[model samples]
Target: MAGYSARVRGDIGRWQQAGLIDASTADLLRRDVEVNARQSLSFGSILAMMAALLFGAAILIFVAANWEAIPRLARVAALFAVILGGYVGGAVLKTRDHAAIGEALWIVAAAAFGGSIALIGQMYHLSGDEASALVTWGAGTALAAVALRSNPLTVAAVGIADAWLFLKGFDYYSRSDFPHVFVVMAIVLFVLSFWTRSQPARHLIILSLLFYLVLLATDQATLPVAIPLVVASVVLFAAGVLVPERVDRIVRLGGRLPLHALLGFLTGLAVIQFELADEHTYNSGFTLASVVALAGIVAAIVFAGRESRGLRWLAYLGFAFELATIYVVTLQSMLDTAGFFLAAAVLLGILAIVIIRVEKRMKDPATGGATA
Candidate 1:
């Protein structure tokens, strides 16, 4: 397949030579391998994007150098001209099949739109409401992305909208307006994710929703906040296990949301642990809650480690921190502390061995013992 790495191709060829797979099967496998790897931008595309950034920076510098000399009308005209030129050039290049360049130009156009909004506001001596300006700019970019069906532009729009929400949320913490706005924006972006079928956009939308949840947590009681997060994490992980294909159809996230939820749950548990430790009581309800949370986190780590390497690492890190913190808070004598660490080290070594064996078994059940 065009997208297959050399090592993968070699393996396929060897399988074909060994008659494990027929030529027709090999061809079908190759055909099934999608060619467009969108996880990273191509080198040329990255260079084009960098070039666009530098060009935009140069234009800004030029305008700043002649700020006082240039008439206000001329300045406004120049700004609009740059914005118009970027969109027109991008459209033309896209039609001509220069997709990378066109994408870069569209990014430039989006940036120019933001700059124009700020400049126009300054020219009119408008009152400073940066949040409103960001919202307007985001709306414009979203419209452009919808019209052009541009993934990069959609990403830009989401980022702008996120910034606006963050600022507005901070500014109106007691009003409950920003949260509603964030919810609406999140819904719009979710729909856009399905329409555009952009993985990056979908991930961004998920992150935005997570951020909104965090913001809401800031207003509620800490224990209540932790409870919901823990519950949501468990539910999300269970959903991933039970209906992964359906989850992928709805979100196109490929089991990542469960991992993210797991991380969030662990983080919330950590926060609760620290909050309890701050109470400085050895036999209080907080202490008991902390212990329960720790055990739950450990169980989650063990369960997730069986399937996901990333989640396994996160679990390891979280468990290590929790164990260290618990020992520091609960142990008094230096000898006892040192013994605790020694026991922990031994347990971790055993865990590593078990994990390696599990991985080997998962990779090749028939030869698991031989491989180990």
Candidate 2:
């Protein structure tokens, strides 16, 4: 929000200089923005948030260290007091026009809620697993995020959910039904992002889905998991790059959906390349994978690169990894390796030409954004 405020101010100045608006009107707009920007995030507020997180951690650690010394009822009272104080104090601060600071306190409360769940479980000697406890904590935080409309709390919930997913499903071959619930968590968080407007949470959920898919592909020798990953990634990227208007109509992420979709495409291609490396037929399999990976990266640049710096960077990273892996696998074949680099150079040169042309046209007002 602070960044948004700055951009708005910059644009206002530009508009004023361009004579798009009168000086008086510009001053009025600046005043309005300045007044509203107080509620947005600032450097000090971020520090306060971090301080709240540290304070919560310190309290939890102190209590745990003296758990046996303190009376059980007093311990329970202290935990509840911590949780209530966080939320209530946050509300008070928000009402006093400290929105970011209040939200930071909400995060402290959320963390305390999770810690209390674990501590109470220990105190009662309850019979339940860590996965369940983490899930419950995440769900509670999510509910609080909804009730409070908190972006920070929503992001925190997504983090907790990812921790649970990784803890329970790091071994994809395990017989853990809990890990399979990641899809539900992803869907819920994705939908919840719209309500809380926590764009980071949306990004995290997408990454979580991709991480889970990669794990799902791991050790599933019976199924061709890489194929599905590649297929899905391509479809998603195409939907965003080709039919962006339609995709954005539903996803409403401006240009971010395509950026992340391209990332997913790269991850899928990387998975394919590595899965093929397992077969020992590195020449054929890796070459095929490299070709596909190169194509995907090029398509990203040609299609969505102009709008997504993230997509462009991801493509660059994918190209580097693809080249390195193929080089490693084709070490025995000097002729093949030389041929591969020469071909890659040619392709990249062509891509560079295309990019140069696109930039030229983008700079030319007559051509505008028609390069797409």
- By TM-score, the best candidate is 2
Instruction: Give the lowest summed-lDDT range of ten residues in model 2.
Output: 363-372
lDDT against the true structure, per candidate, is 0.73, 0.80
Each prediction's TM-score versus the true structure: 0.81, 0.82
Total clashing pairs for each candidate:
0, 0
Residue pairs with clashing backbones, model 1:
none
Off by over 4 Å in 2: 1-40, 171-178, 221-223, 278-283, 332-372
Residue-pair clash count for candidate 2:
0
Per-residue alpha-carbon lDDT of model 2 for 20-113, expressed as tens digits? 8999999999999998787456688789889989988999999999999999999999999988988898989988988877888898899899
Evaluated with lDDT, which candidate comes out highest? 2
